[model samples]
Target chain A: MKILVPVKQAALVEDDFELRDDGRDVDPDFVDLQLNEWDDYSLETALQLKESHDGIEVVAVTVGDDDAEDALRTCLAKGADRAIRVWDDELGDADPVVIARVLAAVAQRETPDLVLAGTQSSDLGFSATGVAMATFMGWPHAAVVVALDYSPGAATATVERELEGGLRQRLEIDCPAVLTIQLGINTPRYASLRGIKQARSLPVEELTPEDLGLEAQDVGEQACGARVRKMYLPEKGQAEMIEGTPAQQAERIAAIVKEVMGG
Target chain B: MGADRALESGKAVMGGETVEPQTLIGRLLARPDAYAAAGLLAAHPDFADHRLLRMALPDRATGLVFAGMRFSPACLLEELGGWQDSAVQRRLAGNPATPAPVIARLLDNSSADPDVGPRLAAHVRTPTDALPGLVADGRLATRVAAAGHPGAGHGLLLELAGRGEMPVLRVLSARADLSTALLARIWERGDRHVQAELLRAATCPRQLLAAAAHAPHALWRRRAAGHPALPEPVRWRLLRDSDARVRAAVAEAPTTPVELLHRFQADPAQRVRIALARRQDLPPSWLDSLARQPGAWLQRWVARNPCCPRQMLERLAQSAAAEVRRAVSRNPATSAFMLARLAADADPWVRAGAAGRADLYPSVLARLADDTEVDVLGAVAANPSTPAERLAGLAMHDDRDVRRAVAQNPAASAAVLAPLATDPYPLNRFVVSQRDALSLATLEALAGDPEPRIRFIAWKRLGALAASH
Candidate 1:
C-alpha cells in the first residue's frame, strides 16, 4: 500500500510584524517558515500506517518554492520514503483549489492507495484542499478525520470524523479515498538524530507544473476561487480592569455576565 | 574590466539602446558567465532587487555576492541558509533579517561549517528549537551562547542546568525570564556561583531566597540577605548569621526592617556597622554615631553616605586619611564649601572625587579640569556639569579612560561623540556605541568599527531603528 501526504511549509509570523509593500500579505522577514502543525499529524498518520502494514510506502509532496524543500526534508527525516516538491513562478500564493489541482495531478501519477493532507494549513486556513483534490480525482473523501481503521487494499475503511461541539460521526469510506487528517489523530514523533543523518543523504525530487502535466491557467491565479484584496489585523479586544473590594468586583463581573448572556 | 564586458553584453541584449541603470545592472547580472556576473554585482553594491539576485543563484560566484548584501530578503536569506557553500551559510547565520526558522535549519545542518554553529547560537533570531542542537555541539562558547539565548525555553534551560558546566550555568543563571519553578530547579543543581547569581536576579523566588538564607555557605546567605524577595523571618535570621559578611549584607539591604538597623549598629563586626553606614537612607542620628566611631574605615563610609550630617561631613573632611577626605568629597550632603576645599587639596585623587560630583561649582570644575593628572581630568570629563567645549577637548585626551569618560559624559553631544567614535581605544568607541541616543552617522561609523562586538552592537541598534520605522 502507498500513502501520499501533501504538506505545506507554513509561515509562522512573529508577535510584532509588518505587511508587505503591497499590503496583501505579511512581510516575510517577520515570518518563520516551518512544517505546518496539521501536516505533522497527517504525515505521522501515514508513517504510523506504514509501520503496521507490509510493503507500505509513504511519499510526501509539497506545492511550494525552493525553500519549501526544508519541509520535505523534515518529512523525509520522519520516515517518509520519498519527497517531491513542485514549483512554478506563476503559482505564487496559489489558492486552495489551485493547490488541490496540482496535488491531484501528482496523485494521479503516483496512484497511491490513500491520500492524506492536513485539514487546513496554519498560515491560510481555507480547509478545502484535500476534498478539492478528491473531487479532481473522482474519489471518496472525508474531512476532519480523527481516527481511521483500515487494512491494506481493503474495499471499505472505518473512519471517525470530528464535528462541531466535540461530536464525532462514524463512516465507511471506499478504498483509495482522500482524508484530511485533524489534530489529535495521533501524536507525531520528532525526527531522531539518526533519522536526520540519513535524511541528509536522501534526495528530494523536484518538479514543475509542466512535469505534472499542469498548464498555467490550470494552477495559476486564473484558477484561484479567491484573491486576497488586503490583509490587516483585527482590532484587539480590550480587557476591562475591575477595581474595588473582591465582593464588589465579583458583583460587577456577575452583572456584566448577566447582561452579556441576556439573563 | 568584467563589468565593462558585462555592460557591453547587457546593451547587446537590450537592443543596443541605453536602458535605466537598474535595468542595465539586472541584465548584466543575468549574464551566462558566472565570474562576469559576480564582478558586475560586486561593482554595484547597492543593487538590491532580491528577486533578480535570487535568479542569479545558479552561479556559485553569486553566493559570495548574496552572502554580504544586507538587503537580501528573508526568503533569499532562508534559501541561502541551505546553500552548499559554508561561507554563504555563515554570512546568513549573522544576517539580522535571517528568520528564526532559517537559523534553526542552519543549526541542524551545522556540520557544514565549524563557525556556523557558534554564529547561529549567537544570532538574536535563533529560535528555541535550535538550542538543544547547539548544546549538543559540545563547544563551550556555543553552549554559552545557547544558554544566553532569549528563545531558550524552560526545558532547554533545565537540560543546561543539569549539565553543571560553570560557564553554561553562569549564563543560564543570569536569564531573568526563567520561571520561578525552573529557577528553583536550577538552584537545586547546587553550583555556588549559580546560586549566588540566582540570588542576585531580581526575579529569584521567595522560597529560593529563603532556602539560600539557610544554606550553610555564608556567601549564599549573604547574597540571599540582599535579595528583595527574602521573607521577614529569613531577613531576621540572616541579620544574626554567624558570618559577619551575611549580617553586613543584611545591614545594607533596603528591605531590612527599621528595627533590624538598631541591632547592626551594636553588632561586633565593624563591616556590619560600615554596611549600615553605607545605606543612603541611614538616619542622621545613626550617621553621626557611626561617624563618631574610631576607625577611619567606618568613618569614611559614613562620610560617603548622602545622609551623613553636615557637621559629621565637615569633621570627616579634615580626617588625616586622604581616603576619608576623598570620601567626604563624594558625599552629596558635603556643602559646596567643603567640595571647593577638597577640590584644592594637595592630593589629586581627593580633587578627582570632588571633580566627579554633579553639584561641584563650575569655577571649581574649570579649575580641576586643568589638573595635569589624568584621574582628575577623567573625573572632570565625566562630570555632567562640565562644559561641552571642555568635554570635546577631553575626548581627544592622551589617556583612554579620560576619553572614555568624555564619551560617558551625559552632556557630551553629537559633535563631541563623533570624534570619539574613531578614538584610538576600542573601549572609547565601545562607550560611544553604548550611548542611548546616537546619530545615524555615528552608528554607521561604529557599525564598521574594528571590534566585531562593537560592530555587532551598532548593527543591532541600526536593525532596531529600521524595524521601528
Candidate 2:
C-alpha cells in the first residue's frame, strides 16, 4: 500500500511587523514560518496508517521553497518513508489550483493507493486544495474526515466526516481515494532523537516542472484562476456600555426593551 | 500432451548447439515459472511479431511487463493509440518509460475517457500548454488543478485573486511569491477576516494597521493594538480605548510605554490589572500594594512575579489563601528560613510547594521528606536540594510515587538507585534508566531487562555515555 500526504509550510506574522517602504507588503524579516497545523494532523494520520499496515510506504510531498524542506524533513522524522519537494520559480505566485496541479502531477508519477491532505491551510484556510487534488485525480474524496478504517482485502475505506452544526456523515468508498483529514483524528507523536538523527541523512528528491514534464508557462501565474487584489483591515465598531449602579443599569435596560416592544 | 512425453520431445538444435526448445511457446512450456518466462519473452524484440506468444500471454502479465518495460516514444505512442483499457492507459500515462508525445496525445484528447483526464493532468510528462485549458475546465477539480499548475499564467492568477469569495482569496493569499502590488490590492479589498490575516503579516502596511485600529470588530482592533509595529500615538489612543480587552492587549504589547503601564495599573477591570501585574517593568512598590490586596487572585499574581520584592513575598507567605501562599513558597526569591516555615505550614499544599523548591535548606528538605502527606514527601524526594542521605532513605518509602520520585532525583546516590533498577513497576525502572549517576554495569544490566521499553531507554542512556567518551 502506498499513501501520499501533501504538506504545506505556512508563514505566521510576528507581533511586530513593519511594512516595506513600498507600502505593499510586510517585511520578510518579521515573518515566522511553520508547518500548517492541519497538515501536521494529516501527516500523523498517514504515519498511523503505516503503523497498522505492513509494507505500506508513506510519502510526504510539498510545494514551497527551501523552508518547506524543513517541513518535509519533519514528516520523515515522524515515519514517512520518502519526501518529494516540487518547486519551480514559476510556481512562486501560484494559487491553490496551481498547487493542486503540481501535486496531481507528482501523484500521477507516484500512483499512490491513497492520498491524505489537510482540510485547510492555516495561512489561507482555502479548504479546497485536497478536494481539488482529488478532482484532478478523478478519484473519490471525503473532506473533514475525523475517522477512517480501511479494509485492505476489500479495497474499501469507511470514513466519518464532521459537518456543520455538530453533524457527522459516514461513507464507504473504494481504494485509490483522497481523504482531507481534520484535526483530532489522532494524536501526533513528537520526533524522537533517533528519528531526527536518521532523517538528517535521508535524501529528499527534488523535482522541477521539467522533471514533471510541465513547462513554466503551463503552471505559472497565468494558469491561476484567481489572485488577491487587495488586503486591508476592516473598520472598527463601537459598543454601547450601560454604566451605572446595578439598579440604575437594570432600569435603563428595561426601558430600552420596553421602548422597542411598545414601538 | 503427457508431461513426460513433452519433456522428452522438447530438445532441438539451434545456433549449432542442442537447445531445450526451438519455438518460443515450447520454450515457455518447459520453464518452471511460466510468468517469468512470459515477462522475458514480452521484452524480446521478436516477441511482437510472434502471434502465438501474444495469444498465450495473459492481459495482467502483458500490462505489468509493458508498464515496466522500456519503449521508444514512437512505439509507446503507437501502443497508447491502440490501448482501450482505462487502467492500462493510466499505467501507460504514468510510466516514465512512456515518451512525452504519448502523454501529450493523451492530455490533448478531449474526447478520451473521463478517467484519462486526471491521469493526463497528473502526468509530469503532460505538456504545460494543456494547463490553461484544464484550469478553465468546467470541472471544479480540473480548474483547481490548473490553479496550482506551475505553468499557470499571471493573468489567470490576477483574475482568481479578483474574486470576492473566500476560497479564491485564500488561494491567492498563500502565494509567498505574490508581488507587493498584488498583495496590497488584496489587502485593500479583503473583508474583515482577510484583513485580520493581512494584519498578521510581518510586513503589514501602516495603512492596514491604521484601519485595523478602528476596525468594527473589537477582535481586529485588539489584534492591531498587539502589533509590534503599531505607532506610539495609535497605541496611546488604544490604551484609552473603551474596551477593556483591547486595553489589555495594548498592555501586553512589549513596546507599551512605562507611563502607560503605570496608568493602566488603575484600570477598573481586574483582567487589565492582572495583565499589568504580569509586566516585569511594573514598579516594585506597586507589587507591594498588590500583594496586600484583598483579592486572592491579585495576590497570587504578585506571589508568582519574579520582580515581586522579598518583603512582598514575606507578606504573601502569610496569605490566608492557600493558593497565594503556595505561589509564594514556589517563588525562587523566597528566603531559606521562609521556605522552612512554609514547609511546616498546616496546609499540605504549601508544604508540598516548598518541598519542590530547589533552594530549600537540606535540613528543611529532610523534615519535609518525613511529612505525613504523600504528596509532600514525593515532592521532597524529587527536590534537588534533598540530601543524598535523605534520598537513600526516601527511596525505601512504600508509596510508589515517592520511590519513583527518588529514582528521578538527579542527586540520588548509586546506592539509592540500585534497588530501583529492578523495581516492580516498569515506570520506576524507567526513571532509574535516566539517572546520570548509575554505573555502566547497572545500565548494562538494565539493557537486558524483560521489558522492551526499559531496555530501549537503558540503551539510549548507554549510547549517550559512550558518545561523551
Candidate 3:
C-alpha cells in the first residue's frame, strides 16, 4: 500500500515587516519559510498508517520551487519512503487550482492507494487543493477528516468527517480516495537523530512539469482560478479607552452597548 | 540548490571566471575547508572587502573559523567584519585575534546584532574607543559586560552607574578595580542584591558591612548578618533582627561569637535553632545538645548531617517520626547494622528509603524484595545490588509499577527483561525497547509491535545496529 502526501513551505511574516517593492506581498527579507503547520499533521497521519502495517510506502510530493524541497526533506526525515519535487520557472504565483492540476498529474502516474493533504495551507487558506486534485483525477475525496481507519489494500476505508458546530459524520470511502487531514488528528513526532542523518543521503527525486505530463499552459497563472489584485496590511480597527471609577466606567459601557443596539 | 545556482549564474553573467574581485572572491571562498578559503582570500587582498566578504559568508562556519584563527592575517579578519548573521559577527567580536578596528566596526553594527555588543564589550582587546557605544547599547547584558570590563575607567563606570539598572550596578560593585569613592557612590543607590555583592568582597569597608547589618530591609540584614567583616557590635544588633531568617543567618555564621551561638540555641524562633543545628562545623557539644531537644525537626537535620555524632544517628534511627527515621536511613554516616534495622522499619516509606541506598547489604535488599507494600518493593526492584533471582521475582510482581521499576534497573539481566517486552503496559514495552542488550529475536519482534511510538524507536535502533556492522 502507498500513501502520497502533498506538502508546501509556508512563508511567515515577521514583526515590523515591509511590503515588497511591487506591493503585492511581504518582502522576502522579512519572511522566514517553514513547513506548513497543517502538512506536518497530514504527513504524520500517513507515517502512522505506514508504521502500523507491513510493506506500506509513503511518498511525499510537492509542486513548488527549490526552496519547497525543504518541506519534502522534512517529510523524508519523519519516515516517508520517497520524495518527489515538481517545479518549473513558469509556475510562479500559480493559484491553488494550478497547483492541484500539477499534483493530479503526479498522482496519475504514481496511482497511490490513498492521498492525504492539509485541509488548508497556512499562507493562503484556500482549502481547495485537495478537493480540486480529486476533482481533476475523478476520484472520491473527503475534507476535514479527523479520524481514519483503513487496512492496506482494503476495498474501502472508514473516516469521520468533522462538521459545523462540533458535529461529526462517519462515512465509508472507496479505495484510492483523497482525504484532507485536519489538525489534532494525531500528535506528530520530531525527526529523530538517526532519521535526520539518513534523510541527508536519501535521494529527493526532482521533476519538471513535463516529466509529469503537464504543459506550460496547464500549470501557470493562465490556468489560475483566481488572481490576487493587490495585497496590503488591513487598516487596524480603532478602540476607545474609558477612564473613570467603577460606576462611571460601567455607565459608559452601558451607553455604548445601548447605542450599538440602536436604543 | 537555488543558492548554488545563483552562484553559478553570477559566474555565467561574468562571461568567464574573470579577475573581477566579485567573481574571484566568490569562487575562492566556495572552498569547503575554512583554511583553504581564508588562505585563498588572504593571498588575493584585492578580492577582500567587508562588503564582498559579507555577501560571501552566509555559510557562517567558515567565517567563524577564520575569525578566531590566531595566525590569520589581520587584514582578512578585519575584512570579515559584521556578517549579516549575528553568530558570525559575535565570533568576530569575541576573537582576541580580531583587530581593534574590526571590533569597533562590529560595535557600530550592534543594532543589527545585539549579541555582538556584549561580546565586544567583554573582549579583553577591545579598545576604549568602543566602550561608549557598548555602554549605551539597549541590551542590559551589553551594558553590564561593559561595566565589568577591566579597562573601563572610573569615568566610564560612573556613566554606566548613571544608568542605574541594578544588574549593571551589581557588576560594577564586584569590580576589583573600583575605587573607594566610586564604591561609596554605588552603595548609596544599590539595592539588596548589589549590597550583597559588596558584602561578599573581602575588601568591602567595615563601615559598609556595619551599615548593611542594620539596613531596613530584612533580606539585606540577612545577607549582612553573614558578612565576615561585620563589626562585633553590629553582629549583636543583627541577632535582634525581628525577621527569623535574619537571626537564622546570624546563627549559621562561623564568625558568630560563641556566646551568641549559645544564646541562639535557646532562640525563640525554631528556624534559628534549626539553622544552628544543621551547621556542619557546630562543636560536638552543640550538636549533642540540639539532638537532645524534644522535637524531631532539629534532630532530623542533625541526623542528615554527615558530621552528626554517631551516637546521635543511633538515637535518630529509633525516632518516632518516620521522616526522622528515613533521614537517618539515607545518611552516609549511618552504619551497616543501622541500615539493616531501617530496612525492617515499620513505616513502608522509611523501609523504601533504606531500600534505595547504594550501600545497603545485598542480604537486606533481598529481604526488602519481599516487602508487601509496592513502594518498598519498587525501591527494591531498582536497587543495584538486589539479587538477580529476587529481581526476577519482582519483575513478575502483581503491580505494574514494580515491573516498570524492574525494567528500568540496569542490573536486570536480559533474561529478566525478555518477558517485559510483551508486558501489558506500553510504557514497560517501551522501556524494554530502550535496553542495550536485547536479543535480535526480541528487537525484531518489537520492530513490528502494535504501538507506533515503540516501533519507531525499535526500528531506529535496528537501523543504527545495521549501520554499525
Candidate 4:
C-alpha cells in the first residue's frame, strides 16, 4: 500500500489568524511555525494504519520554500521512511487553485494509491483547495474525516466528517484519490529522541516544478487572486460601564435589552 | 501549522520514553489530582488539556461542551430540558457528596433559605446589588480578594461570586433581578496588576473610586453610581493608559472640566478627540480650534457644529481632506457661491456634500444630481430642494443607495415614491412607507415588514397619521 502525505511547515499555520491586518498574504518571516494541526492527525492515522497492514510504505511530500526541508524532516521524525521536497522557483502569489494544481502535478509521478492533506490550510482558511484539487483530477473527494476505516486491498476507505450545527455524516470513497483529514482523527505522537537521530539520515529528495513538468505561473502569489488594500486598526467606541448589585444590575440590563429589542 | 511545527522544533524525551496510548493513559491516571486539575483546566480555552481530560470524564459530561467542566449555571438552565441527565442540576439540587464546595454552596434549592444570596457571591468580589447570589456564589469576590484569603484561587468560585450577571440569576436567584460586573479584563499582566485591582474593586458595588464615577472623561468615570473617587495620583496615572478605550474614557467626561478636557485633547487617540467633540457643551471656539486638526473625526465635529468660524470653514473647504471640505460645504450656512464652487470639486465626497445641501444653487444641485459619483447623485436625490420631477427621475437611479436616498427625501412625491414602494432595499421600501402621502393601506402593509426597525418606524408614522385623523 502506498500513501502520499503532504507535509508543510508549521510557521505558516500560526500566522493564519484574523488579526485585523491589511496583508492578505502570509509573511514568511512572521510565520510562527508549528506542525499543521490536521496534518499531524493524518500522519499519525497513516502510521497506525501502516503498522496494522504489512508491506505499507508512507511517502512524505512537501511543497514550500528552503526552510520547508525543516518541516519535511518533521514527517521523517514521526516515522515516515522517505521524503520529497518540490522546489519551486517563485511561488509567491499563488492562490488555492494554483497550489492544488502544483500539488496534483507533484503527486502524479509516484501514482500513490492514497493522497492525504489537512482539510483546510489554517493560514489561508482555504477549505476549497482540496476539493478543487480532487476536481482537477476527477476523483472522489472527502473532507473533514474525523475517523477512517481503510481497506488496502480493496482500495476503499470510509470516513466521518463533522458539520456545523452539531451534525456528523460519513462518506465512503474509492482510493487513488484525495482525502483531507480533520484534526482529532488521532493523537499525533511526539517524535522521540531516537526518532530524531534516525530522521537526519533519512533520504529526502528535492524536485522542482520543472522536474514535475509544471510551469512557473502554475503556483505562487500572483496566481493568488486577492490583494491587501490597507492594514489599519479597527475603529471603536467607549466601553459602557454597568453598575448596581447583581440583582438590580440584571434587571437594568434586562430592561435596557428589552427597550433595545423594542419588546 | 499546529503540531506540524512542533514536529520540526525537535522531538521530545516522550518526556519519559513511552509513546503507547496505554502508557499515556497510565501516566494520566497515575496522578489522581491531575485528573481533577484536568477537569478544572478543561474549561479554559487557553489550554487544550480539556480533550485529554475528556478521556477520563466518565459517561456523563464527557467530550467537548467547549464551556469546560463547570458549566455556566445560566447555560445549564437553558438546557435544563432534562435535569436527570445533568450532573450540574443534581449538584445544585443539594447533593452533599459533590466534591466542589461551589456545587454544594450553589445547591440551597430550599425555597425558605434566607442565606442563599450571600452564599452565592463567588462570581465577583463585591455584591453590586442584593442579588449577590445572582452575581456570585458567596460574599463579593472582592472581600475574598481583599482578605488575600489562602483559598482565593479555588478557581472561579471568586470569579463567579463577583460576576453581576448570568448563571447565578438563572439558577440561583429565586427572586427578582441580577447584578453583574461587565468590567471584564481585556488586558491583564499579573495577579498584582492595577487593572486586576481596579476591576476587582469595581465588581464590589460597595467600593468606589471617586474619579471612576465622575471623572471629566465620560468614559472613565463610569463605575457604580455615587462611588468614591480614585486617589488624585491614581487618576492622573491612568492618563498613561495604553488602551484608547480606557484613555478615551478619561478624556470625554462632563466632569473633566475644561482644563482636563484640553489636556486630553492632545491624546494620541483620534477616537478620544471625536468622543470629546460629541460633548455638545464644548465651546464653539474650541470646536473651531480643533477643526484644523487633520482627521476624519475632527471633520465630523466641524459638520455638527454650525457655529465654526467662516475663516475655519473656508480653510477647511480648501483643506486637502475631502471629508473636512465635505463637512464645510454640507453646512447649510455656507454661501451658495461656496456650494457652487465645491459642487464642481474634483473629489466625489465634496460634490456629494454640495449635492446634499438644500440651500445650494439650483444649478449646482442639478449638476450634482447628475455628477459622476454614484454617492454624489444619491446626495442630490436626498436634497429637499430638488424638484419632485428630479426626485422622480432619480428615484429609479440604478445605485441602491442613491435611489433609497431619493425615496427618503421629504419632498419626494407619493407618485415618485410609489414606484419605489417595492424596492429590493428595505430603506427604499421603508422610506416610501414613511411618506405622509402613503395611504393607510401601504403603511399597514409595511407594519408587517420583516425588518423590525422598519416596522417600528411604520407603527410610529401610522400612530401620527391616526392622531391627525
Candidate number achieving the greatest lDDT relative to the actual structure: 1
lDDT of 4 by residue, A135-237 (tens): 8777788888888888776767888888999798988788777888888888777564356557878879988878888766666556666544554346986
Candidate 1 lDDT, tens digit per residue, B207-271? 77888877877778988888887889898888778999998888877887666688777788998
Give the C-alpha miss distance for residue B351 in model 4, angstroms: 1.5
Q: Is candidate 1 or candidate 3 better by DockQ?
A: 3
In CAPRI terms, where does candidate 4 land? incorrect
True contacts kept of 4: 0.00
* B90-167: candidate 3 lDDT, tens digit per residue: 677777788877776776787776667888888878877678877676788888888888988788888778777887
User: On DockQ, who's better, 1 or 2?
Assistant: 2
- Quality of candidate 1's docking, in CAPRI categories? incorrect
* Quality class of the docking in candidate 2, CAPRI style: incorrect
**Across residues B1-469, which tens digit of lDDT does each residue of candidate 4 receive?**
0111111111221123223333323444554332332322322322234344443333332211211323222222222313343223432332222234333333344123323333333333222332323423344432333223222332333344344333232222211121233223211211212222343243333333543444453443433221233445555655555556665655554554455567556667787777766666667677765775777657766665666656666767887777777877767667888888888888998888888888887877777767768888888888899988888889877778888887778776656676675565666776676566554445545555544445545444433332222
Fold similarity of candidate 1's chain A to the true chain A, as a TM-score: 0.90
lDDT of 1: 0.79
How would you encode candidate 2's per-residue C-alpha lDDT over A64-141 as one tens digit per residue? 988899889888877999999998888877889889988998999999999999999987899999999999889999
In order of listing, the candidates' clash counts read 0, 50, 0, 85
lDDT of 2 by residue, B1-469 (tens): 1111111111211223222223433544454222333332333333333433343334543443444344322343345445665545656655656777677666666446555564455555666777656555455445444444455566766665565455456555555456566567667566666666666565677777887777768877887888888987788778888888989988888888767777765688887778887877878887776666568997888898888888888888988899999999988788888998999899999999999999888788878877889989999899888888888888877777999999988777666787677665667877887666665455655655544456545544433332222
**Superposed Cα deviation of residue B438, candidate 2 (Å):** 3.3
Isolated chain B TM-score per model: 0.64, 0.60, 0.59, 0.47
Show model 4 residue runs off by greater than 4 Å: A1-263, B1-207, B210-247, B264-304, B331-337, B361-363, B422-427, B430-436, B439-469
In candidate 3, which residue ranges exceed 4 Å CA deviation? A5-45, A89-203, A207-263, B1-79, B82-91, B94-119, B128-145, B162-171, B174-177, B189-204, B244-278, B283-304, B309-469
Task: Assess candidate 2 and give its lDDT.
Answer: 0.72
Give the per-residue lDDT of model 1 (tens digit) for A8-91: 999987654568889999877556789999999999999999999899999999999988998998899889999999999888
